[model samples]
Target: MSSAQYARIKLGNQDKISFLSNLGTLLAAGIPLLDAVGSLLEDSKGGQKKVMETLRADLMQGKRIYASLSRFPRAFDKITVNLIRAAEEAGTLEVTLKDLRDHLQQEIEFNDKVRFALLYPLIILFVFIGVMLMMLVLVVPKLTTVFYQLGVTLPLSTRILIFASDLLIKKTFYVIGVGGALAFISYFIYSHKKSFVLNILFSLPLISQLVRQIDLARLSRSLYLLLSSGLPITVALELSAQVVMREQTAKMINRSREMVLSGKKLSEGFRTSKKSLPTIMTRLIEAGEKSGSLDKSFQEISNFLSYQVANSLKTITVLVEPVMLVGIGLAVGTMMMAIIGPIYGLVGQVKFR
Candidate 1:
């Protein structure tokens, strides 16, 4: 099989979640590590089976579980590998596995919610585009013929509509090809220049806040997980930066990490290095530091940011629905009035024999 085909068979996020949960449960039930892996291998298939076999063989050769897992970078990220390494040394593998499983599950749920939140706006845009296409292709052409037959002076709006309809009808293939090319170009730009696109997003008012909060939430959650798994604050911050979506947010986190590395307090580093860092986060971290519970502080921050994100998503959905409906209503209404106006005038000008 090609490398790409081989890659496809690797464990996905859900599969990894299941693996972790099952392994954690078996370990908690007092099963030996080797036996737990062996039992899991019975029902495993494809890449998972291959992984389990390798793990079992490695364990037989006296390799540690984390060492075996570190080999599958595609299946287990750096954060997972490092956490498992900590767990093995700390003798908390079962707890760490369950915690990791829950963390991954939470990430999946949050991502699904984010997708669902944005789904409405995309649906509205596509529906609006479809309405425009229908008007241009079907409705406007018939109206154009009527207006021509009546010999009435067409208003500017109607004339514009007619011109658009004519172009759409006469150069349909060209229009479609251009649209497809534009879409492809747009996708390419977004994929290659994600940071640039994200920068633009961060400049927008409403969306910027939402996007930032989402990234912050993810960063905080990652930090909480890493810290809970016994990673150092600086290391946690570095790994957390890698997981965030916004380049700007990641940069800010990295800056904080650098400051923290220089023997600065985590809260002080965040407050100094990140100008737009929320004051609440700074205060909470400071407090948590004083109490030696920085991980709990991050968990609290994650919860707060998640709440705000949920509210923001709800507000967007509530506002977008009415705005889209009203905008579409006005557009269609104006077009109908323009089409009907000239015909109405022509009917009135007709004289009885």
Candidate 2:
């Protein structure tokens, strides 16, 4: 691959996990790092192949592994780089690699669960919209002509349906163009104004709570890994801050890091900042500090927060399913009433012949 292609080639989670697991196993078995990376070339393909080749080349040139990994920011984030660097410095590469693989696997599974939980509601909404649009364009106009031909007053619901059907059929291109433009604009704003969008999300009830728990879970998990790998507390906090998505949570972590550097206890910093942190986390950290097992405390906190996030996702899925079903039922009932109400009125006016 060319330099530009190499720069653009980002590996997926599974690829990184496989790379770490294999490399760690080889190193544990007393294989040299350079030879292990070279051996991985037998199975590597595409971007992963490029990555392994580059790493082997870097190692041959006497550059550190972490330095080579830092070149691929998209594939290896800052947190991964720092952890590996710490491992290399402290002679714990095998252990850190194993931890990294397990961490990545957990992250992937949790992300998949969250995505699957939300997918059902989105599918239902899109299906409902598609069915409604088909009825408006294909079915409503035909029934509207019959209602007007009866020479009797139509109900308000029928009139509204006719108006909508006429608009869709007559201004189809205009509607489509406007809709496409709006969708593009919405996507642009959502991408470029993430903090603004997050602010809106934070104002929501269920969504805000879910967002908080997910970010906390990520932060705690990252801190646990970084601290357990022999990283300094402030450095661990700083790296953990980058792993969370919420702007507020990241700022709070950064503030906590500053406080830790100023000689305050980590839990004291967390408790004092308290911008977006929960009391439970601070309390756990305090207890962990007193017992001289802060890393273990973060591990427990991560587990608890992850469980809460999973349960919250399940609860949301359950609640949204019934609400969306009732919404679809209401929409269908209105459409049925509009179409059938006029026919019932027309039948009553006819005399027996």
Candidate 3:
């Protein structure tokens, strides 16, 4: 992947989460920081081991964990590092790490579910493409030979198929080159054109809702974590924006931050933002503000959105699987008919003669 690709990737790493979870456990067991680091270092290997050793060295030099973590921004995002800094200062490192561990676990699980849900469709698509290519490049050529040998006037469909097969078999390198270039250009455009990508994403039907729910879930959970860590609301909102994946959602968050500074409540800003996030979110935020429990309210909203994300993904999987299968079947059936029908016609003419 290019640097732009890495820049656009979601925050958090599974290995970092495992490390945080284990570190928290060790800390809770009353182990000194140095010994814990050493033990972890002993068990580590490869690039992760190198990072751990650097961290251990930093600790040995009397630097803080968050300070060391800040050096590796790719692995530990600003939100995670700040949370650890706050926990370190407030003397709640164990609890903070555990909370972070839980957050990372949820992120990992969500990503895994999405990958699995999409995997089936992708596999089917690849298989369909493979079968189609084989028929076009291999099967169609043989039929084309037979039709030419018999001097039969091929149907329009067969002629089209023959033309396509000629392109596949004769212009093979040109096709591959064009495909490779398209893939690269697509990646570049998608990574750089944030607003374009967001607009396209939100224009889709089911996908639009799914994207919004997932973004809302992430933002709510981020706010809950940051606010619960004793950060000011403004700071929390700013940091929470960085944790979300969508560019438009991040822009809305920044807009809400500006609104908060101009004497508007966070709930009002959330309600009035361009996206118009769920009404229930604003209602609960209002209630939480009145009761001085915004953290809990945000957590509840996060939980609800998480469930919605899962349900929406399941619904998409259920609908798309059958549609894809039917589409493949129809495509293959059409191609077979196109290739075979002319041969049958030629055979009948021969028998009549």
Candidate 4:
């Protein structure tokens, strides 16, 4: 049977990879494909069950699994379709699904690592802000009332603090309004103008490098999976682009595909592009071309980019922690000085009297 004969099937949820892996195993172990799908459907829950039932119905209609999968673009995606096509062509659907599962697992692990690295810093920043705001808006004002009642001549710093606290308390409504407006504006910009702004921002030095590495990692992994499944280069690039989250990276890949179609070498196309593909990535692409093992080259590039991203995240975490701590310390220390300095000066004056 030609690889294209398999019906299109869309799998959703975090459990999708696991389900596919199990189904592949069952099929490989002499279970009929339909029965295996039925078993999966029976075991499924939530959106997964809905997807399986839809696939099962489509299968009964004599549609290919890949075609059925196309109905749910969100779940299956182009990469999934291309991989299925390649697997079908190579007569290794089960093995391809297993490999896809492993690839997805690695991606999940990498994402979790990034989240773990950021979580502590985020929590610390939140707590620091909360404590500082509490001290400034709530605690300092109550303490300042004591010095005021004693008829003390407050220092410039303490006067500044009192003024700020009074202003914040009196203009609290304006503060809330301004904060809400700024948040709304930020949300609007993020939702509407994100693409252009994000592209510009991601082009900046260290941050741009990190973002580019992440995009390269995802691009290389998707390309590797598609190419390894025996897909054509152009087709694989097209499919891989679909999985790329960054619009800029996707655009670069699409442009590269166009260049390839125009008879330019793939590596040269990417190398000549203004897009931020790393030199190492271009070299790997060239090596893949020379070795006729583009799939392996893509995998190697993915590994390199993944390692770079992990290291970058760790560096960012380490750098941000000390910077945030210093900022919090300075802010808190300044506030404390503002409050205590005036009180100490008042006590010294009374002693002199």
Candidate 5:
């Protein structure tokens, strides 16, 4: 829970989206910029309040909103800064912020939907583990002592269960310490070796697809926003690359930007990088290039990728439920047989005696 709090402090997607939405509303209402920011600062709560206060101070010092936000890279990611910069340059900051807020809200809702879908399975898993641990540490040892007093010779499985239960009861602290150490080491490695972690993440099959779609959605959205605001294609591509979360995807986009700068067509660059793009996206880009509607095409691509990712997440959640149920059933069944099978055999032997 403390980790979750720290994560929220680091500018979670939901927090930024909420802030952007409120800011957009304030801006759209014709409020003065500094006054609106000051009001927001006063209303802000939790970890984000400090960020808002700092931003307001910077605004008072003659810095633009986007530039002020740039000072807090943890709070305002590159994509956010690029969108705000585009909006300011186009004299449509309010409109752009509203769009960005909408995009961020959609992403947050999509993530929530995924989490909601997985909630039941997660609950079941947690309950199963808790029950199993209690049975192992509390019930098993007592049953073993009873069997010993009754002069009953335990079966191999029962002996194994008793040994495991004893070990768990005796070494629980050691196990917990090791687990904590491993968790800390994992976090340290993940934070310091981002490229390595990202590469390994992208190598997974289903997760790789999901990540690619997410990257494409972000790239297309950022590119659309920049291009529609009249940024040059080269600059839009470069900024979009910075906005991409995946290192591999960013590298691909950078290469595509280079191709565009070298006189290659946008469609050609996309077509050549099909691994980083969907076939539908390639076709849409080609058509947009021919029709001079690249901005609209990018928007359509963003929407399509967003839909795909949402559906994929739903599919994954649906698939995980039955699989988790089966796993829990197997674990319980195995434990019950280990405990009950010998009891039935003992009853038969007592009847014979």
Candidate 6:
């Protein structure tokens, strides 16, 4: 059974890369695959060691490395397994493992760039929310009690804040219950593709751009690796399409793959896929086609796209932090004005009377 057919345990990406790199190095040094697994087990601990030991047992049973690795779906994802399969068939398992390591490293780099870009703004947002919530829950009630005793005529903004504070303080359990239920329902429906939220998110301009770039980079990199490992163009496209998380990009690729099947050029397929694919990408693919160096072309395209994604992430971070900060500032300023401005007006009225 393939690893996908068996129960698999998820391995950390860094750990997976380390193990694969070690295995590749050992294989290059003329060790048998079985001995390589044993060597990996010696240096490994915890879940990684267990995964290697399982592979060693499977290797002892005369299974090909790819087939045995495939059985652990958690340890080896489909892309890794397929690349290994192609490499094994082509007698390039060692080189394939090295390539796989490089592929994963690039992926990690891309993801880290994106994650770091969003992390600062998200943290700021959370801190803003927490501070606001605490003030509403703790400070608002006491100040409101003083206003009530003093017979101060509260403004509409103050009334709204008071109501919100009541909701958070008096109905805390109900608020939690409703929020938790809504979150769970949303996640379930969205994950199952039954939620309009998913469709809406995919259609947003900023999200759409980021998704397309990321998916394109991954698709090109995967195709390059699979093709370099001797996989057919059709299979490479098919497998890589599955790795592209964006529905639109995956659809574009599948359409392009069908075009390739129907004897149409892949570049033309991408250009006309009804998605906003970049002209430069289409031109690169055309160049690859013309030069009869499609794999090399894909590598270049992937590298270029990776650079673009990093730049996009940097741009997004630069733009979003300031915008988010301004919004938070406005929100906090409005809240303070609403709460304290009325009190000032009331004090003026008392002096006049």
Give the top-scoring candidate (lDDT): 2
In model 4, the worst 10-residue window by lDDT is 1-10
Model 1, 1-353: lDDT tens digits are 34454344558897899899999999999999999999999999878888888889989999998887777768888899889999999999999999999999998999888899889888988988898889899998887887788788888988888998998999989999999999999999999998888799777877887888889899889999999989998888888888877787888888888888888888877787455668898899999999999999999999999998999989888888898889888988988888888887787777531
Q: Which stretches of candidate 5 lie above 4 Å from their native place?
A: 1-15, 242-246
Ranking by TM-score: 2, 6, 3, 1, 5, 4
TM-score of 5: 0.87
Arranged by lDDT, best first: 2, 1, 3, 6, 5, 4
Q: Candidate 6: where is the Cα deviation over 4 Å?
A: 1-5, 194-196
Off by over 4 Å in 1: 1-10, 46-62, 67-74, 351-353
**Selected candidate, larger lDDT, 2 vs 6:** 2
Q: Output the better candidate (3/5) by lDDT.
A: 3
Candidate 6 residue-wise lDDT at 5: 39
**How many steric clashes does model 1 contain?**
0
Query: Could you tell me every candidate's TM-score relative to the true structure?
Result: 0.88, 0.93, 0.91, 0.87, 0.87, 0.92
Model 6 Cα displacement at 204 (Å)?
A: 0.9
lDDT of each: 0.87, 0.89, 0.85, 0.81, 0.81, 0.85
Error of 4 at 280 (Å): 3.2
Better of 1 and 2 by TM-score: 2
Tens digits of per-residue lDDT for model 3, 1-353: 34443334333376787689889999999999889888888887755676688779889999999987776767788899899999999999999999999988888887787788889999999988998888887788887898899888878887888998999899999999999999999899988996797688776888878878888998998899999998888999999888776677888899889999999888878887635587788889999999999999999999898888889999999999999989988988888788778878987998999
Q: Which wins on lDDT, candidate 1 or candidate 6?
A: 1
